[model samples]
Target: MENVCLSEELIKSQVLCAPETKVVIHGEDCSVYKIENETGEGVITRYPVFPGIEILYNDIHMTNGVSHNEAPRPNVVEINHCRVGRFECEFSRGGSIYLGEGDLAVNVMTNITNQTWFPLSHYHGITIAVDIPVAESILKQLSEVMGKGLDFDLSAIRDRLCAKNSCFVMRATDSIQHIFSELYRVPQDLKDGYFKIKVIELFLFLNSPELVNKREERQYFSRKQIDKIKEIRQYLIDNVAQHITLNELSQQFNFPLTSMKLCFKEVYGSTINGYMQAYRVQMAAKFLRETTDCVTEIALKVGYQNSSKFAELFKQFMGQPPSEYRKSFVQ
Candidate 1:
């Protein structure tokens, strides 16, 4: 509902994006998308990349389905098939969603899904699908549902995804799909606040598949994969407070330093420093968001060597200074 409309200038900027933004900035590739969600047909150009989100209307005859983005390749949803919503889709470790040909119109989120097994770093597309709906009645309901705030169990999403152990993923998806279908099935006037959020939930769940820890029970991992990841997890936990070095793994595991780096990098899907930083921040966030400890003290306790350094890192990691972060979560 917030300025969901795109301006001509914004479109121009996107269509004329630079090539090196993703590289020099360590950012993801962006694409320009202009598909209308209309009942009539049309052909949409697939300019692969993004500097900004581009959605335009093409009323000419082509393929009606080319209007909504189920995604041609993890790209933004662009199409004109009575589009009811928009959602940004992004994957860091290479994520994809296949919406069959010439725009996608789904009563359900995924008909037959093919998800990659990679560490999809958070590539958040704006829930444009939510924005496209012309019904406030439906949007209202969706806002309430999604706005109930995330059901976060303080988990940073499972670093790995498992498809065949339990049915959390499938159940969650189906549960949401049913909600969306029920809403869309209703007359538009009666659909009030129904489809978009649930649809967003369906996609978000798929995007952020869960990770199972050593202690928690869940439905992913072959024993072999678990063992390997667990080794890395344990190594991290054991050395939580120590300054990790590239060569340290060689000393501890007897692998050559390069092998250790390669293996750890491969397993964790990021540099060793990035993983440690995330873990440290996760741990630090708990204190900032839960306890009353002073920032300096908390930082030191979390293995940061200096308070100044900790404060800077805390802000970088949490989007706010430690004091502000602490205050926000203070009861």
Candidate 2:
């Protein structure tokens, strides 16, 4: 595994303009690092609102298999929001969390080197990392304002948030989406103040009574199980035009059918069929944009023998008919 702290070095090596990828401090507590490569660009901007509280934004274009990244930090609490694409994170322990759009994952660190991979060619998101002690103080102050007592121990909360191997996934509710969307729309001039405010707002939302019970922990899988599931996923993608059955996958991977289904869902946040359908549609869309192939031929290439059915599915997934979708870009 690569050192998480200096994964930036990995990027530097691939970046066309290495010197442009550098860090710049905005104020006493905020820093921003800009990264650019041949395929795309990225910026990691961070605001240290408190002694140990940080709010960061990651806007990047990521191509598949470009690279994987890991960061090793101890006792770090991170809240990740996937605004655009999916994030597949492999924890040091044994499991992985697949965070999709409007999904949230809270990760508590313990000197673990967690690796993050982008499933698509692009990713854009924001993350807030808080230190336990720092959050304790903030929680205390917020409690006093509400005239409420601190019934739960901060450490306990920390442990629970990261319970079951250090990561939990939650759905981003409407309120949560609104908060982050507003943050994204903030004017450049007001970004500094907005960043601090949003970080506090996020904590408040997390602590709200409505959200506590709604929090759903991500399911955990052993390293071996997860690896096999990943293999299955890749195999499906590689042979997108073909139909593969659960029994076949299970027998091939030596995994129980039920376990394979559950584990695949846990890692990809979708059933195997659902994931395959999505992948096929994505591949079809790529063909529409990059190739001059007609809709019927492209449909067959992606495993769809019926052109009309292919167009219907493509419209459902891509929001327009194949011809229009292609014309929008090509014309």
Best candidate, lDDT: 2
Write one digit per residue (lDDT tens) for candidate 2, span 1-331. 2222223332232211133556665444455676655556667776555555666777767532233234544455677888987677665565666777888877666524345556555667877766666557766776687665443344665666665545667886798798788877888788767776777677666655445456775566787887788789888888888878999989998999999999888766679988888989999999999999999999999999999999999999989999999999875
Q: How many clashes would you count in candidate 1?
A: 38
RMSD in Å for all candidates: 21.6, 6.3
Which window of 10 residues has the lowest lDDT sum in candidate 2? 8-17
Q: Which model scores highest in TM-score?
A: 2
Cα deviation of 1, candidate 1, in Å:
43
For residues 1-331, write the lDDT of model 1, one tens digit per residue.
1332322223322211112212111112223333233333222222111122223222223121211222222112222122222211122222322121122322112221222121221111111221122223343454577785444311122113322211121211343344334433445443223333444454354334332222223222233442354465568767777776657655765556655555455444456778788778778889877777777777776788888887888789789988887778766
Taken over the whole model, the C-alpha lDDT of each candidate is: 0.38, 0.69
- Give TM-scores for every candidate, taking all chains together and pairing residue i with residue i: 0.35, 0.74
Clashes of 2: 3
